[model samples]
Target: MSTPVYEKVALLGLGLIAGSIAWACRRDDVAGEIRGYARSAESRDKTRKLGFCDVVCDSAVEAVQDADLVVLAVPVGAMGPLAREIAPHLKPGCTVTDVGSVKRTVIEEVAPHIPEGVHFVPAHPMAGTEHSGPDAGFASLYDNRWCLIVPTPGTPEADVARLEAFWHRLGANTERMEADHHDLVCAVVSHIPHLIAYTMVGVADDLSKVSEKEVIKFSAAGFRDFTRIAASDPTMWRDVFLTNKEATIEMLGRFTEELFALQRAIRTGDGEQLHAYFTRTRAIRRGIL
Candidate 1:
């Protein structure tokens, strides 16, 4: 058999993304040994009981002791602290990656602490469900998804290609982009949509009293989908919005402008204008599919 892509891989967090990575890497034999660390004892116990890692470390530093690849799968807000904690323990020449949703702030927060000789390849796997925690993960989450690799200027070409191949083996289609650009695009496509879903669902909940339980009883699949997205781990989404502030704010600004226009169209009974706008959005969805 060919050698495994990574002899030893360490995962910083053991939530959905990290658990999915462990499952995928093991299933595909991408890494020989998987070491995992979680801050909470409960999480660490779950990681061990789930058999997600070859060895479970008590601390992030111990997790990266000899890992050739270290993936930080924590919330975006925790990236800096985790990076600082693991920097001293990362083996030289190791490739440290992340499965964060946002890129710009992560690069700034996590990159500085990476020691010399260690390579940092910031990546965002454009995949995941509304689920959180290890039990909610599956090996196929990354399958057929786009994994964006945002590389710094000085990263070695070979290392970049190797990491790209790693994600490919995990069943992801890989693309490279600038960190800032990745944040901007994700904020528009994923972040703002999630925010809107949460708001709409919350509004429905608030109106449930007037609806006399009809809203909950008669909710359709469309609203159900919104509830799923809105129900995603609050802490993770909170960190995402906080860490990727500029992009989220910019997208929110644009979203508010369109929302006002939509409200105006409704008040004025501008059916033609509304129809054209909806048609345009439908085309975009069709393109995505």
Candidate 2:
């Protein structure tokens, strides 16, 4: 067999992203050994039982000790403390990356903690289902997905290329962007959608008790789709909203304005306004290509 792309990769947080990475690395021979750690003992055991990693450690520091590549796969809020804990134990030349949704906050929190010789490459994989946890991951999750690399201002070009290649080998298309811009773009495109889904589902739940069971039992596909997104990991979504507050709030304001305009068109029986609005949006999508 050919040599693995990496000697040993450490994963700090064996959730959906971490588990999917482990499976992909093993399938593509990207890493010789995968060491992983989760927040709880039950998760560690479940990872081991599922064959998610070669070794499971009890602590972040222990998991990352000799790893050539360390990927933090926890919630955004946990990145800083985990980075501080693992930095002291990281190998000198190891490359550390993350699969966070927001790039700016993570780089701010994680970059300063990395030691002198360690390389930090902040990345966000634009891929995931509403489901989470190790059980929810599969080897195919990263296949053909776009992974954005947001390197710091002074980061070396060679380091960035190497990290980009790493994601490519995992079956991802790579792009580079400024960390702050990435957060704002994701807020408008990804974050705001999830927030709207959550809101729509919440609205349904809070309706009059007269139709409570019928809401769930006779739900249509559109409402069901909102419910699925609303079921996403609460802790992760909470951190996402909390950490990326400004962008989300700004996007939400625009969203509400647009929604109110649509509502007005319906209330006033203005068919032409609704038709023109949807037509303009469809043209915008056609231009995306």
Candidate 3:
């Protein structure tokens, strides 16, 4: 067998992303040992029962002690405090990375708390289901997915390369990007879409003219998919929007303008305009396929 990328790895949150990372690392034998910690006893218990990590610690301090790589997989809003709490405990030369969707705020919040010798490399793995919690993780969750490594200025190149290699071993394609650019790209691709999903679901819920039973019973594939996206962990999504507000607002503004154009087309009975718009979107979907 090949040598492990990191001899010891610590996962700061035992939720879906953290659990999946632990599982994937173990599956690939990329880490000699994996330690995990969760804020809730229930989540900790679940993680222990699932056997994702070699050791499950009750506190963040315990989990991170002496670990070479520490992963913060908690919600974006929780990263700052967690970083501060673990800063003193992190082993010298250890590398710390996060899986938060928003990059700019995480970098700003987490960079300061990192100790001088410790490396802080912020990462965002563009992979997950609407499902969450420890039990929702699977070894293949990140397989073939894109993992963006957003490095701030002055970040060590060696540390960034090591983290990229680790992600590659976990079956993900890795790319380096600036934090602000990563935030903007994520807002366009992920944050805005999630907000739209939540809004569509909310609109359906408020349509009193459509009975609740009918809404559920007669739901189409499109509406069902929206519901799935909207069912994502509320805490994570809440923090994502809050942390990536500027980019999200910019995307939302563009989305509103396009929506107005579509509404106008429909109101004016412009079948030609509707056809052209849908045709363009359909081609985009095909490109994705």
Candidate 4:
């Protein structure tokens, strides 16, 4: 067998991202031994049964000890406390990273807890279905996806490059970005869109005349897509909005202005304005395609 990138890797949370990482590492020979920990006993038990990690430890500190790479896959809000809990046990020179969507808040919360010799590289893997949890992950989840590495100003270039290579081995295209810029880009591409999906779904639910059965049965592709996005893990999204408040709120403000303009066009029955706006938006979709 070929040599592994890291001899040992510790996964601090065994949810979809971590579980998928373990699976991909095993499939690609990325790490020699993988250790995992989950806050919930049930999650630990499930991971053990699934056999993703070489060892399933009882605590975060135990899992991370002596590991070359440690990934904090917990929710955004929980990162700081988890960092503090595991800092004392992290091996010197071991690289620590996270899979949090919001980077600036994560850096503020996690950076201070990292010990002197260890490295902290915050990353966001732009992949995942609405489903979460250990069972929701698969080895191919990250294939063709983009993993953005948001390194701080003082971060070592070698460490950033190593982490970028690691993500590449996991089948993702890697790119480096600044933390604040990453948060703003994600707010426009992901966070605000999810909020809008949730709102539209909620509006559908609030319409008394539209029975729940009818809503489900008569759903078009657009509404169906909205429901799929609205089904994302609530705790994760709540922390995302709270932690990335400035960017998310800014995107929401812009979204509201555009929505009001569209509403006015509809109220006034301005067919030309509606057609032009829609044509321009449709061209944007074509650009994506």
C-alpha lDDT values of all predictions: 0.90, 0.88, 0.92, 0.92
**Number of clashing pairs per prediction, in order:** 0, 0, 0, 0
- In model 3, which runs have C-alpha deviations exceeding 4 angstroms? none
Ranking by TM-score: 3, 4, 1, 2
Q: Report the C-alpha lDDT of model 2 over 5-82, residue by residue, as the tens digit.
A: 779999988888988899888878888899999998989989989997999999888899889999999999999999
In TM-score terms, candidate 1 sits at: 0.96
The runs of at least 3 residues in candidate 1 whose Cα sits more than 4 Å from the true structure, single-residue gaps closed, are 208-212
- In candidate 4, the residue pairs with backbone N, CA or C atoms under 3 Å apart (3 or more residues apart, or in different chains) clash, namely none
Worst 10 residues of 2 by lDDT: 203-212
Residue-wise C-alpha lDDT for candidate 3, range 1-289, written one tens digit per residue: 7679999999988888998998899888999999999999999999889999999999999999899999999999999999999999889999999999998999999999998889999999999999999999999989999999987777789999999999999999998888889989999989998999999889988988998899889999979976788989999999999999999999999999999999999999999999999999999989994
Tell me the lDDT of candidate 1.
0.90
Better of 2 and 4 by TM-score: 4
Error of 2 at 75 (Å): 0.5
| Error at 3, model 2, angstroms | 4.1
Off by over 4 Å in 2: 1-3, 283-289
Model 3 poorest ten-residue lDDT run: 222-231
Model 1: colliding residue pairs: none
